[model samples]
Target: MNAIFGWSVLALVFLDELLAVAAFGVWGWDRDPRWLLVWLLPIAAMTVWFLLASPKAPYGGPVVRPLAKVVVFGLASLALWDAGHEGWAVALLVFSVVVNGLALLPSIRVLVEEG
Candidate 1:
């Protein structure tokens, strides 16, 4: 279970990064230079924050922190998607939710186990 959780978290991280890159690329092609920076800053900040906060690798610990971060990022993506109304933004929002949902699975499992 720990191994699965670890790999799933890794996958979510990978997907999140990939989507971010894709969003930047699309923004560049669309000639919206500002969005490239906009998309990167938050992700970079979150990556740093996550690394610092989970220094001991807290995947198997309580789920609240991870869930909170996921919710925040998911909402941010959704807001961007809604604001742009572009296909790429929509795709990014969907990808964010799915990846975050996968990341949340371990927490959900923990909740079930506790009950």
Candidate 2:
């Protein structure tokens, strides 16, 4: 991959995580000191995401990759919508799909050929 393209993919991944945090943070914006729930969502999601879908997943399997991507991105959209940011949710949904598709094209291609 081109260096620029690779950087953009990394940027998108970072942005996705930030958006997830923001989505939940919005809900805990003015809540009581029990704001712990707000932070936990992203932490849990990122943990699962990194383990299952990271480029360097501790375990390897074709099935886990795409499935994890969908699940994580879907959770993000839900979080945004739940927090009353329907616009950002929809935008993230679209952006995640596009960027993820492009970023994982090589892996996807291999899977397609094997299947």
Candidate 3:
């Protein structure tokens, strides 16, 4: 059951990240197709994410991981908000802080502990 719950949480987080990337892409595409950034921004975000925030990424030392998460997810929320998705942005923020917090907090480590 613990394993199931843990994987479920991970799946949700993965989907959330994908949604964030898409949100950024949509925002960029809306602003100006002529600007190369419309495509590059989301690509850049994904690259930075894989490099710095993936579970096994070499750069994600414990100290750096949380900060990287904030940068990645925070940028996603901002992208949604700037794209006129204030509700989605707020929901994402709450999920990141609360859901992720539930998984990360040592006293409530259900989503991360071994089954």
Reference-based TM-score, model 3: 0.80
Kindly list the per-residue Cα lDDT of model 3 for residues 1-100, writing each as its tens digit.
3666667677777777787687678678768752776778889888877878766667876878778888888988988899899999999888877666
TM-scores of all candidate predictions against the true structure = 0.42, 0.75, 0.80
- Native-to-model Cα distance after best TM-score fit, residue 82 in candidate 1, in Å: 7.8
TM-score of 1: 0.42
**Tens digits of per-residue lDDT for model 2, 1-115:** 4656666676776687667656656655534554776677667877877788776677536899778878888877887787788998899889888877776667544433453
Better model by lDDT: candidate 1 vs candidate 3: 3
Q: What is the C-alpha lDDT of each candidate?
A: 0.54, 0.71, 0.75
Candidate 1, pairs of clashing residues? none
Candidate closest to the true structure, highest TM-score: 3
lDDT per residue as tens, model 1, 46-93 = 564355423243442456556555554555455456447466666666
Ranking by TM-score: 3, 2, 1
Off by over 4 Å in 1: 1-9, 21-44, 51-85, 107-115
Error of 3 at 18 (Å): 0.8
Better of 2 and 3 by lDDT: 3
Which candidate tops lDDT?
Answer: 3
